[model samples]
Target: MFERFSDDERAIEGLPVRLVIALVVGIASLSVMMNTIGGLTALGVTELDVKPQPEVVAEGSNEITVTVITPEGEPVANATVVAKDGTATLSQIRPAKTGPDGKATLSLSPSLGPNQAEGTITLDVKPPAGGGYTDDRENTKLLVVSGGAQSS
Candidate 1:
């Protein structure tokens, strides 16, 4: 077979051109994938911002509104919001979920302690499944002043 083919042709067949082409393609694909991942990472994580509500409320159930969004201002839906008090005694908050608009309203009832009439409420907001987004939380103060005194 070597008699019919030139020496150069035989050397070329031994070079494994197909294998080299496949390796190059594989590397290119991997590079593209890595770049895509890096880009997504640079986009940063999600953020949760609790709207400004009354700092003081009566000794009853109060409603709080929170908004979840991305760094780019995109609404984050289906996020979980948890509220708790420092002493966990004078605050009753139910876990709420964000709607399509990234807004969740939580009902909080200020508990009156033996001698305490003011306390802080913490809101923990968690992103949806996947680690692509980071979780955020905030704290707000609530003072139990009088009955039906309106939130201030």
Candidate 2:
């Protein structure tokens, strides 16, 4: 009985079926893009940077400091700093928080592992939760020499 309503009547009341569907599809596409971008940002898609200077130092005599920052030169604070020789030497520095200058220091070990006394080590800096920064590690020639009395 309702087959009498013509397409003109439906168009007069609102948009045509195709136009309505297009509007809904456009809105849904926009929403999907926004959500995708938000998810990527939350996943820490950005890569951070870590620079260590004076890569070499005398064990138990000096400390190796690493500066953490973003590609845009922004300082990253409240992150975890870890140093390792890629073997058995590892140090989880305390007060790992980066200062206003985005610098964190870790002491070198004087006690070498087995027959080794001094070598290179890699630095890993991870941003604090919800800190809006990504994790980074040293992939360059960052090394420190350890040859002195072990410091407490």
Candidate 3:
């Protein structure tokens, strides 16, 4: 059997409805994405300023005091401070938490490799939760000298 089709006018009855649904879905998704991005920025972010007392130390057992503060120079209390080996070798590092004065004392025994003149000990801070504090920036570093005397 052979049939001949007549082109009167092709009708797209459901095309507009499908297009409208897609448009609505797209707008809703965009709105949700924008809100999520806006929420992150709405949460205030604070930068940590870590400082190690006696910036330079001899290659031996020493007690270093670390202070955590905000950019506004306000001390950040109850924050955790961790000392890690950067270019130096650390014997053991016990993470310390800051007190009301935003100061934590850490006992670190750093050693330098043979023939190594100097090295660095890196410090990191973890601000208290819900404080909107960020520790992504560079922190203070401690200098460990092989033979030089420790500085106050």
Candidate 4:
């Protein structure tokens, strides 16, 4: 003989536990995926190129032109360009903003150690705000030779 169960004994209460767990897991996964995509979109979308008029300079004052462009080589205007000392000693470099031509001229004074033969000055750029541009690529370097000698 089999015993019959009552309706109250078989009825489930509130939300199904499996459904609640699935909803929480789905929401968490969606949040993580969205964050990952957003972070990826914020990187390496732009490039910065530098052309030191002479490509090489003496141990004193120098001028360098920085160009902000996209991966397609299209110019990006209003970007800010910054300079930093690499293996060379340099005077404080003032940041410059690019014009409509995507060019910013920076004045820098690069110097070398008394015994160092040559060094390099590094350049970086920050694309205009809200343009979804990133300055994560290697820009360019300026060569500084000793004794006021320029590289051929």
Candidate 5:
């Protein structure tokens, strides 16, 4: 029994104090860790970052140069160019940005049916991540085709 732990005629038959203390400390440490992580997570620090959808610019154009210039009229490179018809959406047309001369070539697709609305061509420009802003060209340009060639 525990009474025999002294210099008696018996031996202690139980775990040592050090082992018990170690187990308790380990459990407490784990609990604190879990609580800290849970609390930090419960705060508004979720790992969900959503980006605002880029607005679509419908200045329809065929063989047009959409120069996504900066506030200082400097061209943007490696930017995303999307042309959409009011009826259907064209696949993301991401061509290389303008060269040092600030010029990019754009060739409009004539796949839409003559009657399928061909809707409208909206030009949405996602400028480079640095030193520029998104350009909402607005209803400025509209490419109207006539005689199988770009009219305006």
Candidate 6:
């Protein structure tokens, strides 16, 4: 076999590895400093300058029952209901779907006070994207979770 190329001075190459390392380290250090400054700024800063006032709801006692009604003023069957309050919060509050009368009643055991208790019950629906069904609770109003109530 051949004895290989003579003392190969042209076989080696230089890449300035120090420059590459310095560039990478400089980028990393800049990122870390930016993250630290951002974290410090967010520690005590509020997102909004003016805090909106919450709606004043009536005081409620233990075990507050809720009935979910659909957009057409009809009760939504098999709809999930959630009830939350200041002291304690409940999830999947009740099971019993709507009956033939399209009415589902959800009762919260040992409820909470009027300290801004808000509950959101969502239902899953198919999206137009042709994908699997998506959550459509935001678009539907099964149960009213806001200030004031409709007088029957």
**Considering every candidate listed, which one attains the maximal TM-score?**
3
lDDT of 4: 0.78
Expressed as tens digits, the lDDT of each residue in 56-149 for candidate 3 is: 9999889999999998888999999999989999977669999999999999999999999899998989889988898888898999999858
Clashes in model 2: which pairs?
59-146, 59-147
lDDT for residue 131 in candidate 1, whole number 0-100: 42
Give TM-scores for every candidate, taking all chains together and pairing residue i with residue i.
Answer: 0.53, 0.52, 0.76, 0.75, 0.41, 0.28
Best of the two (4, 6) by TM-score = 4
Q: For residues 42-131, write the lDDT of model 4, one tens digit per residue.
A: 464554455445678888877777777776877789988888889998778668898998888888888898799989888778778977
Candidate 2: regions farther than 4 A off: 1-44, 87-95, 110-118, 136-141, 146-152
- Which of the two, 5 or 6, has more lDDT? 5
Residue-pair clashes per prediction, in order, are: 2, 2, 0, 0, 7, 0
Residue 34's lDDT in candidate 2? 94
Clashes of 5: 7
Residue range 46-128, candidate 5, lDDT tens digits = 11111111122232434656555554555556665555554444455434355454455566553454555334445555555
Off by over 4 Å in 1: 1-43, 52-55, 70-74, 87-93, 136-148
lDDT of 6 by residue, 1-152 (tens): 44667755544444467678899999999999999898764343222111001222222322323344443354334444433333333433444443444443444332233654544333222222322222333433222233344211
Worst 10 residues of 3 by lDDT: 1-10
Q: For residue 74, what is the lDDT in candidate 2? A: 74
**Per-model CA lDDT versus the true structure:** 0.65, 0.62, 0.89, 0.78, 0.47, 0.38
Model 2, 5-75: lDDT tens digits are: 56336555555777899999999999999998887753645567776666555544357677777777676
